[model samples]
Structure formats: C-alpha cells, structure tokens
Target chain A: MTGRVIVITSGKGGVGKTTTSANIGTALAKNGASVVLIDTDIGLRNLDLLLGLENRIVYTLVDVVEERCKLKQALVKDKKNPNLCLLAAAQTRDKSAVDADQLKTICEQLQEDFDFVLVDCPAGIEEGFKTAISGASEAIVVTTPEMSAVRDADRIIGLLEAKEEIKSYRLLVNRVRPNLVQTNDMMSVDDVVEILSCDLIGIIPEDTGIITSTNRGEPIVNDENSPAGKAYINVAKRINGEEVPFLDINEPKGFDAFLAKVKTFFGIKG
Target chain B: MELNKRFIVDLSQAKTPADIVFEVSNILENPEAANRKIWLKLGDVSLNQSQILSIKSLISSINSTLSLIESECSQTELAAATLGINTKDVEEELQAELSTLEAESPKDTPSEQYIPLVDYKEEEPKESEHEQQENKEILDENKQQQEEIENKQDEQTTQNTEEQPAVSSDINQEENKKDEEIQNQLDSIFDSEVKLENILADDKDITEMQNWPLTKEAEDDFEIPEEIMTDEDYAILQMNTQYHKQTVRSGQVIQSNGNVVIIGDCHPGCEIHAAGDITVWGVLGGIAHAGCKGNTKAKIRALTLNAIQLRIADSYARRPDHIKNIYVEKSNTFTPEEARFVNGSIVILKVNDR
Candidate 1:
C-alpha cells in the first residue's frame, strides 16, 4: 500500500520544522510502521544531522532528482530503526536544482514502499517552499508561540489552501514554554488556535532535553524520561487515528509524571 | 417603444459629442426613471468611432444600456460604429466613402459634427399643447410609483445578494418579469405621445451643427484623456512626522520616509524602517532600521533599546552578547539609549550622553 505524503512547513525561519519532522517520523517508525523523511532544504541541510545520519549520507535528494542515483540508493536507512530511513539534501547546491515536477515523481516512487513519507520543507514561501510542498497531500504547519512565527504560519496556511494538491492540514505549536504561557507573559495554546483556526495535532513544550539530543545528533524520542520526548510519542499515536487526548500542558505534573514512568516501563520510547 | 418604458435621446439634433454627454448625464441624475436603456434614434445623425466610444463609456458608468436605431446611414456603417474601434487612421481610409455618402444625403446636413466650436441657442419645442398637459399629469403619478418601487427594490436586491449570491441568474429572471409588468401598466396610460425630451439645458439643446469647421479640427476635439501618460504629482507636503500609539506585534512591518515616533513597544520579529529619525517612547524589541534612504545622519532613539538588530543608513549592528549578560546580571541598571551612525558604524549610547 502507498503511504501518505505529508509536508511539514513554516513560513518563518528558526522555527522547529526540521526538528518536528525528525521526531514525528521517528515516532511513527518506532511503532512498526515504515517511514521515510526527505530533507528538501537543499543548500541548508539539517534533517539528516538531526537524525544523526549526516556522515552516512552518500547520495542526496538532488542526486536522485538529477538521475545520478536510484531513489532507493539515495535513501539511507536509520541505524537504530530499520523501518525508518532518510533522504539527505545537497548542501553544496541550491533549491533551483530541483523543480516541483521532479520532486512529485520522487515522492510518488517513495510512497509505494513506505507507510509515512514526511517531507521537511524549507523556511520561506519562495522556490524552496513550492518545490517541497508540490507533492504532498497533507500539511502540518509548525509555529512557535511568538507573533512572527504565527503570522508566517498563517501566510503558509493560505498558500497551502490555494494549492489543489493539499487536501487537508493541521497545526503543531512547537517550542511552547508552559510556565511563561501560564503567567500571561507569552501566548497560550488557545490563543494560537483562535488565530490559526486549524485542528491542533500536538503541542511540544520547551525542554532542555531537546537541545541536548540535537547537539548529540540523536532523536529525542529515544529518551523516555524527557517530557518533550513523551509529547512526540503521543503525537504519533494521535496520527494513527487513535482518539488520544492531548497532554495536559497546564495540568499539575502529578499524573503526567506518573504516566511517563508507566510508559518507560512499557518501553514505548525507543 | 412604450413612452414610459424607455428613455429617448434623439441624436438627430445633437451637434457635438460633448453636447450628447451633457444631455445624458442630466437625465440620469433624476431620481424617478423607468428603464436604464436609452433608445438613441440616429435618424439623421452620423457618429465617428470616438463619439460612439465616448457615449458608450458614459452610459456604462451609470449602469445604463444603449440601443441604437439607424434610419439614414447604411447598416454596415452603423455596425462599424457600434463595433467600438479607434478608427482615426481608418477615418482617413473611409474619407472617400464618406464623401460619396455626403453626395447622396441631404444638402443642408453638415459633413462633420465633432468640432468643439458649438452654438448654444434654444430651438423650437417639440411637444404639442394638449399632449404636454396630459404627459405632465401622468409623469407626476408615474414618478411617485417609481420612487416607491425603487426603494423597496433596493433593499430586496441587497438581501437577495447576501442570502443567495449563487442564484444571481434566478434573481435576474425575476427582475425581468417585474420590469415587463410595470411597462405594460404604463403603456396603457400614456398610449399617445409621452416622449422623453432633450433632458438638457435650453442652451445645450440647440447647439448648432453648421458652426463646426469640417476639417482636421475634429481630431483636435477628440484627444482621448486616457491616452495621456504625463505623471502629475499632486501630493502636498503637509506633515513631516508620524506618530503611532499602538503596539507593533511580531511579523508586522512599519515603514515611513519621514520621522516616526511610537508610544508603544515594537515586539520581537517586527521591523520598522524610516528615512528620518525614529523615536520610540516604549520598549524596542524588534529590528529598527533608520536612514533607510542612506541618510547616515539619522538617529534611532528608544526608552528601552532591546532590539535584535539596528541599522542606520549602511551601518548595521546586532544585539551584542555582553548586552544579554547586562539584562541578566543587573537588569535595573539598564538606561534609555539612542543609536546613531558614528564613523560608518552603528553605536548605541545612553540618551543623556548626547
């Protein structure tokens, strides 16, 4: 069976689009589903590094688009998870090297063997954004609580709605500081949903474990104790169409701490 | 046509394009009117390409329709006029054909009718004594009903558009039936002579057709205003400064070519670019670029200059690492500062230092 091609995009830069793509793809693959993450950023390649497959990348997305290598050859299998793989981007070349039609053909080929194909899009609404989203049927817009990221995400949603290929979309607010949101200093999750007007798939709070994992070139989903890691695992469960209630970001930590330990015992986080 | 159904403009008496436009505008301004279609009886009048286009644009602006009737001119020439082409070049091509047309038509009729030299003298009235009195009474009653129907119809049309905008074709069909019913009732009342008149001032009604010089002067009168491309600067230098009182949120960009003063904070990820000096009375947390037009002399002043980036003309600076430490170590020690270009580099200094 063919997989669903999903594009993860945010119009503004410095938001966690690559981080979200890496975590979500890993979370899906950890559940015994075959998943492939395509890094389409071209000149600014980071998704492979986030998944700790940077040095192992011998064939890139541009190589596949140029017919220099077969699509299967370009895909590098994750060392830890056999069901998860990554197609790295070319750091030397720019986005103009790959057109929208070429990417569409590559995605169609990749979807046949994978259960979930997540395309990590670039930052802006320029050529790179168009090339990354041209093949996807579903979109997940990542936005921070800041006004700049939210406004840019709104602009991206408008562009996605205009495209006939995109059938549906949902929002994921990354890098949320629960303490700041609770004290009224920062924008809350409800405030973001009111403005964006989209189904919120998940909310990943600010955690020091995310930075520690990214620096070490390891996916945070491997750490069961981390709250950010648990959030990603839950997001994967929700994506499977299991009516999973969201993590109570504002609720007292008594139940969440107990449940996170229960999940650790069950070996849900890999 | 029914007398009360359509407005009439007998082009036989109109001498110039300007005179026809003037008459039509007058009739359209009246509140009580029947149909928007103006029946132009071109029995003895001839129009060039420019005159037809000018009349068409005028009627279109008032949301009215024009239907032409030809009696003297050949059907081919009438069709060519209504085709809406700029035929100044082709007018010279048709000069020979028009000369033959002039040879066959009435001798007293002028060959050219577009000259700006017009005579504004009154002509004899067309209404008969008995018909004029009967038309006046019927017109008064018809106008009252017209006003009432127009007000009710305006509200109904707005409601229809708001409720079922997708069914506009159905609304058009219903309106056409209502118009036919109204026309039949008016036709039975004024069955004789209730013609729409000149609808013009007495002076404009009698503009002499013979006063026009029938030469290259017609082209001079038809210099289309739309073709002129000269750019005119109508801006007045009234205010050299702008003040905004509301907070500028993230991703919002505010720019000006003059000095700007803001009473609220500029949040992160937002940008403000100005050509002149910028003064922020509140916290400045975003990117502020002054001297946008390469005016290095411009300065940016803020009560709390906590911006991510600052640029004055060609020089630029980002928030230094030490500044972040200052916020953490001794946040209360921070003071109001203004940034300016000093020797091709942007430097922030305390406001009291200046």
Candidate 2:
C-alpha cells in the first residue's frame, strides 16, 4: 500500500521536534500501522537513540543513497515493535551526503511497503531541512508557546505553504504549561495558533517525564499515564483520521487547585 | 616478635610420590607460598629418607622450610622423622594453633581466626602491637605447648576408644568444613592474580583463529572495492602517519592517506578516517574508520574506546545501545583499548594486554 509521507520539523532548535516525531511514530506503530521513521538530521542524529535502535543501525540513509548498501539493509527495526522501523542518519557525514532527489526516491520506494513514513527534519531552513521536506506530502510544525518559537514556526509555515509538494501542514504547540498560562507567565496554545493562523493538531503539556524518557531512549507515548503521552496518542489518533477532542489542558486539575488553595491559606501568593 | 606463619599443603588425595611432588610444585608456584613454613599432609603414600630429603629441598628452594609432615603411612612418617621434619598429628596441631590464636585475640570470630592459615602474609603488617606481644608470649611458652599436646593426645585416645564411630564421623565433618574454607580462601587470592592471565589467554586464542578478509573479494553484499595490499604497503602506511594534538570536536572530519593519530578527545559527530591505523590518545567518542582504503590490517586504538561507531576495513560495529553515556566524562584514569577486524567482526581488546 502506498504510504503518506509526513515531515516533523521545527525552524528553531530544541523545540521538541525529535521528541514529537518519536512519540507520534511510536503511537501510530502501536496502533498496528506499519510505520518507518527516517532521521534526516545527518551528523547530529538523535532519532535512533530515541527509538532505542542506535546499536542496531549498521547501514544508514547515506549508505542507501550512495549504493553502499541496499535500502532494506538500512532499515533498523524497533526493539519492542515489529511494526516500527528506523532509517537512521549517518553520524559521520553532513547533509551533503544525500540530496533532496535521493531522499524523495528512497521515500517513494519505502511507500510501497509501509503505511506511514515520518521524516524527522533537522533544525533549520537550510539544505538539510529542504531535503527532509522533499520526501513529505504533509508537515507538522512543532513549536513551544514562546514568542521566538512562534515566530520561527510562522516562517516554517510560510515555507511549507510555498512548497507545492507539502499539500497539508498543521501546528503542534508543545511544552504548554497550563499553570504558567493561567498566571500569564507563558503564552497560551490559542495565542500561538492565532498568531500563526494555523490549525492545531495537538497541545502537549510540559511533563518532566519526557526528560527521563528521552534519556532512557524510550518514547513518552509508551507510558500510558503521562499527560504528554496521552496528548501524543490523541494526535496520532487524529492523524489516523479519527475525530479526537483536544485535552483540557487549560483547566487546572483537582489536585492542583487544592494545592493552590492550601498555598493561599498559608498566606502565600497562589 | 614476628609470628612464624605456617601454610598447609594437603596432598592426602595424591596416591603416588609423583602425584605428591607435582601438587607441591604447583602450590609453590603461587608467590604467596614463598618464604613461609610449609606443613605437608600426605595420605597413604610410602616414601624413603631420600624422597623426603628431595621434597624438603624443593620447599627450601622457594626460601620456605618444611617444618612439619603428617602421614598416615608408617614408612612415610619414619622417613619424615629421620629427615628432622616434625612428624605431628595434623588435627591435634591445628587444635593447638587455634587455641593459641583465640587466646591472644578473644574478639575475633572462628572464621576470622581461621583466615591466618592461608592469609597470614597479607594480614601481617596490619597486626596490632598488643597482638604481637601476645604472639611473643605464646611463642616463648614451649613447656606449655608440650603440656598441651600431651593433654590433647591423652584426651584423643580416650575419646577414640569410648566413642569410636562418633569420633570418626566428627573428624570427617570437620575435615570437609576445613577443606571448603581453604578452598574459598585460595579462590579469593587467585582470582585477582589470574584475571589478567585469563584475559591475555583469550586474546591469544582470538588472534590465533583464522580471520578471512571482508573486502569485496569475500562476496560481501556491501559495495566496498577489493584492494589487495602487500607487505610493502603496510610499511609505507606505518611511515606516513599524521599526528594531531588537539581536541577533535563535533562536525569535524579528519582524513589521512595512511595513519591518523589524535592526542586529544574525539567528540561525538566527528569523523576520523585512515588507510592504516587510527590512534586517539584521549577518549574517542566519534566515528573512527580504519582501513578506509580496504587495508584489512588497519586498527583503531584509543585511551577510552567509547566511539559511537568503529570501522575496520569493510566491517563496522556500533556502540551497544546499553551504553547510555552519549558523553564520555573526562577523567584521569582510562583503560586503553584496541579494536581490530577478526573473523568478519570488530573485536576490541585492552591495550595493556600482549
């Protein structure tokens, strides 16, 4: 079956682009859809580590493009899920190793076998980012709820709109802290979407579990209890063409409200 | 006063004189058996005076003296007595020794006191002054030792006749317990010394195994070209070595026609390629490719071989995923390692091993 190619990109670095790609890909694979995650961030790849398939990678995307190894030989299977695979980037070579046409060709060949092809794009609008987007028909622009990130997201959206190959693009505002938003300390999800005038696919809360999960090289979506994991699962469901409602991140939970009341009773500003 | 230590070599299982000599020589190979008093415990093997003299000389060769011999054979006991080696009952002598040590140190447990039989050399310098003084007094009590031995012998004879079966069974149980304790003590001592030798032996075995080259001539699926090199090619590679004395950071690439040597850390994301060998004097945390030009004899050596990927010839190996440390913490101590292509796989070894 022909697969839909989607690129996960963020113009600014460290905006959870790799984390989003890993979680969404894992969530989709766990739903029984065969998914392949391609990390195009050559020379500084982290997607293999996130999927815990770093050691399993022998050949990579550059090896496939250079004809050093076959395309099938470079696909490293996930440790836990047979339905998931990873086409890692070459840690020794830079973006010049594989061009845009070569990536598009690889993606086309992979589309015949898998149900979804998720390309984890590098942090920039340079040649690396261009080559990553060349193979995708859909885009997910991840951004934190901050002015700089939103501004970068706007630029990325503009670039995606200009590219005819990217038929659809959506916004995923990550690291949205509800308490900080309620206290007017951080930008709200609505503000980020309104500024960019883009439809929101997901709003992930700031969860400290993400750090430990990243270090452990496991996707946060594997953890069923984490709020960020639930959000990512919901995003995956939306991508599967299911109408899932957004999480009520704006509302303070019962425990949080109780803690705030206790603080106010202790003569502290809540 | 320094207490004279006694090491017991139990050869009761040896059936012949040859077996006894072989076992004694093997035990003496351990440096711990040197320069101490040795007590030989032989089972039913008969020996003459000349045989006992040879054994005594063998013990003395390592600066050790054969102070005592306990033999169940009358001929062996006669020969040992003629040789002036104290012929004593091992069980009675052991009882006396334990009583003396316990009287000197009342706070030690039975197992701790038992350690002196095999662990005296290592524990000597740590002896307390009060313990030394007690040892001196115990050594000077020759009359008391003679009296204690006579008293124990009398008690043994009476108990043996009164409860013959029970006494035999008790002796069997105590002998088994003592054997296990000695075995454990000897294992602990040999483990530290034998570990390096085991690793070196393993390295030798791996090197001796036939290693087929993995170039394109090997019918490999990878598209690496086969370039056969002669001995002269390797000599040229050894001559044309390049040395860099700086930290190789991320995104940097170092390529050489022959060998490449980096005197600093090679951080992750950096690449080092050489036709021959790649040596890193510091931590290697990047991708290192030796034999990039299809020389199967190329090798990679590093102070800390933490490279994300190591490539020798056409064979490559990635760092196992269980190694979670993406960043190798800089430290003063390092275990240098060398990686070479062996039997179509990359094998790493400690550098200090021959």
Candidate 3:
C-alpha cells in the first residue's frame, strides 16, 4: 500500500508542528516504514535543527522545487534511521520560491519511494503554509490547549475541513501540561478537541526533555526514556495500523493503569 | 473475489486542496484500510482516466444541484438582504423563454389565473404584505402540506446564512427541492465608495501606509473629550487624532477583550495594541496591533486601509492584504463591507445589515 502524506501545521508558531513532524516521521521510520520529513518552513527553517541533521543538508526543499538538485540528492539521512530522510527548508530564500503546485509535484514524486511523507508546515497562513500542505494526503493539525493557540487552531482546522480531505485530517495536541489543565489555568485536551472538532491522533505532554532535546537538535520522541517520547511512539504505531493503548498521562502512575498492568501480567483479558 | 467497478464521483473538490481531506475520503470508503487502495487526488486537470470522467459527471451534478441549492441559497440570500431580494425578478426570468410557449399555447393564461402561489405576492414589496395574501395564496397554489411547510420555512429564512447554526441539520432537506432555474437577467449592481457624509470622524496616524494618495503626520495625540454630546450633534463633528499611548513591550501583542478603540487615524508606521475586539473609526493605514501580549481573540475593524504593517497581537501580519481586484460583480467585496475574522481568513461582508 502507498503511504499517506501528512502535513503538520499550526497557525500560531512555536506550537510543536515541527516537533510533531520530526517525532512522527522518525517514529514511523523506526517502525520500519520509510518516511520523509519535508520541512516547508522556508526562511525560518527549524526542522533540520530539530532533527539534528542541519550539517548534512547540501540542498534544501527549494533546491528540489527549483530543480537545482534532485529530490533524492537533497534528502539528508538521519544518523540513527536510514529509513527516514529530512528534506530541509531553504534558509536563504523565502516561502514564494516554492508554490503549492510545485509542492504537489514534489510530494507525488516522494510518495513513490516512501511509505509516509510528513510535511512540517511554516507558522502562518502564508505562501509557506500553503506550499507545505499542497500535496499532503491528510493533515495532522498541531495545537496547544492554550486559548490563543486554540483560537488559531480553530481557524486552521476550519480551513483544513473546508478542503475535500477533511476526513483524513486528525489533530495532534502538543506542549500540553496536564497539571495546568487540571488546575484550570490551561485548556484541557477535551476542550481543544471540542473546539477544533477533529479526531485526535496524539497528545504530547509538556516535558523538559522536549526543551533539552530541542537544544541538542534531537526531537524528544527519539529519547525512549521520556514519557512524551513513549506517547509519540504509540502515536506512530497507531498511524501504522497497529492497535496500541494510549498512555493516560494523568493516570499513568494511577491505580487504574497499575491494576491494568497487573491484569496483563496475570494473562487476564482486558 | 470479483472486482466491483462502482463509479465513485469525487464530490470532494471545489474547496480546499488538503491531504487529510483526500486521505479521509478514501479512508471513509474503506476504514479497514485493506484490499485495493484507491487514490482520491485533487486538481482541475484530470488525474486519471476514470477520475477525469468522474469529475465531469461530478461537476455537472454539482451544477445541477447548485441550481437547486441556489434556490435555497437565493432564499437565504433574499432572507439575508434586509432590503429584500426581488423574487419575482427571478420568476420573470424563467418565464421569459416561456412567453413563446405561452404564445403557442393560449390555454396557459386561464390555468395560471386560478393557481395562486401562497408564498408569491404580486406586489412590489412581497415581504411587507404577508398576512392576507399569504393565507389565501397557500390555499390557491400548494395542495401538499409538507411542501407548504418547507416553503413557509424558506420565506422565514430571508437570509444568506442563518446564525445560531441550529438550522444546519435542516439545510440539506431544503436544498433537494427543484427551483425555477432562472439566470440573473437584471443588471447586477454594486454600491461602493462608502458615503462617510460628514459623520463624526476621528483621524490621525503615526505614518501612513503604502500607496495612499494622502499622508498626514500629527505629533499631537488628541484626546477624546468626555463631553456627552447628543447623537445628532456628535454626528456633525469630524474628530481625528494620532496615537493613544498604551505601554506595549517588545514582542508583546496588543489586545482588547471588548470592542477596542484605536482613537486616531493609524499611520502605516504606527504599531497598534489590540486584542479581543478593535474598532478604529478612522483610516487604518498602518500596522495593526493585535494579540499584543499574546491575546489571540482580538480583531481590528477600520474604515479604510492603505497600511504598511499589521499585527494581531505578537503575531505580526506585515503589510497584510493587497486588494488585487475590485471587480464590480462576482466578488465578496462587491459592496462597502466590513472584515471580520471568519473561518481562518477575514471575510468581507456588508458593513451593515443588507
């Protein structure tokens, strides 16, 4: 079966779209499906830095679109996974260098080799945003549960749904802190999902590992030790058609899961 | 197992070209994601042989359905028009070609005289004289109860769109009915160049935005003197200003939870501080201060724009919109309109109830 091209985008910046792309693309690749992470955030490119493959990018997405370099040539292989490739964005040029039509063609070509093409969209609803989602088979709209992010996410989700492929779109809630939500200071996943009104693919909790990992140019999902990383792995598994249980962050250490683990060990049916 | 070649019409296009949309359409048909894989692609160009064929039929069906939908759309459009959309105009358009048919058939006149359309009023303002004409017209025109109810509902829905959105569930049922397919025979007209007409106006700016013919730089930040003038007296004076200082830190967006007032004619150079709601009566020709301090619920309303910069709080939309075409007809910006945050983008609707 051919892979689906998923564009991860958020209307407001710093809402973990690039993070989701790197993590999901890498996670999907780690599961043995060949994945390509196409960073469409031109001028303000960060996916490469997040992926920790910034130095290997001899050519960027603009190069591929402009035909300065072949699609395969511009693809920088991640150090850990040969299955995953990072098609970096052009830092020198702006978003207009690649239009939506060109992106569609690029995705079409990339679709032939890969099982999944995950596009990391630029922040705003500009040319970069349009080009990023041009050929995506579906989209995973990333948003925080915060009011401002949710409002922007609401708009983006509305725009995405107006597209014919609305059914293929799912949401990814990132940088969510369960404690803040519990305290009512932050909007909960339920509130965001309700407003956005889309099927949710993943929920990433606010973790310090994300910050440290970001600084190291490595996405938090690559770290198996982190709780957020496990969640991303589970999401990747779900995307790949595997039946995986969600890790309830609020109740991960609670009695319900504690009892469920006991039940699994005893070979009892759940 | 035999392969089924059922014709799948792509009713999904004519909107956005998003991936989740294509994937979801394919996924809906086969949620199992097993068996033969089908590609649901988007393009004005024919994607494949069957898809090309499918798109043609889809377009025709959509057009035909749109005709039916336009009746509902027109009914809503009429309902929306506060000035009232001329329904008889549409009816006359359909009958224009039928005049030859009527000329051929002499019996058409006598039968038409007996059938009184309950909803149809043979008056200039059909909506105004509803009581006596409606009760008698329904008895004369429609015999079916269900059709009468639906028509009555249509009459109540004199609007382009209904808010409170409770009617979304019922909208589909109304769209199925066949309507008189009459093209707009009347010359479509647009009323533009809003008549400010010596209304009480306040204006001033930091620096005017792009290619505006006039630029005014006023150093004085004028004050809105709290003299409670009568609405009529207030309407007479044309007030204006430059900047109403509110401390906005770097990277901090401006926001207002309520209707915000940008007290001056904003220069293209001025950075506004606003969130929630913003209302600038004067020309907004500069940078919009939005989401200032990270409040995203803000929106800006201005009389005119030839601005250089725009920011929705900390999120800056620099020199945001370039009005490419001001077509007289066939555009949302067909009249003097107001822009509000709708969907993801700003939609220009009639300034007041129209």
lDDT of 1 by residue, A1-270 (tens): 899999999999988999999999999999999999999998777897677665345458998888876788678777688789899887657899999999999999989999999999999999999999999999999999999999999999999999999999999989888778867899998999999999999999888998878876778998977888988898888888878877767743567767877888998872
Kindly list the per-residue Cα lDDT of model 3 for residues A24-100, writing each as its tens digit.
Answer: 88899888999999988777777876776643444588888888766776777776787888888876567888899
Assign candidate 2 its CAPRI class.
incorrect
CAPRI-wise, candidate 1 is incorrect
The candidate with the higher lDDT, 1 or 3, is 1
lDDT of model number 3 = 0.53
Q: How many Å off is the CA of A223 in candidate 1?
A: 0.8
Which is better, 2 or 3, measured by DockQ?
2
At residue A74, candidate 1 shows an lDDT of: 75
Mind giving the per-residue lDDT tens digits that candidate 1 earns over B1-354?
Answer: 221123334444544333354445544554332234444544333444444544544554454545443334453244435443222222342365356645766344223222121223443233332333434544454454345434644433233111111211212344344444443332232222211111111121112111211111112222111211122111112226789998987557789988788998787556788887788877787768787876666778888887756777755455532233212222445467777654434556554431
What is candidate 3's lDDT per residue for B83-141, written digit by digit as tens? Answer: 12222333343355246555765444321111111332222222211222433453454
Residue A128 of model 2 has an lDDT of 98
Candidate ranking under lDDT, highest first, comes to: 2, 1, 3
Q: What is the C-alpha lDDT profile of model 2 across B216-240, one tens digit per residue?
A: 2121111111224669456646658
Model 2 chain B: which ten-residue window has the lowest total lDDT?
B191-200
Fraction of true contacts kept, per model? 0.00, 0.44, 0.00
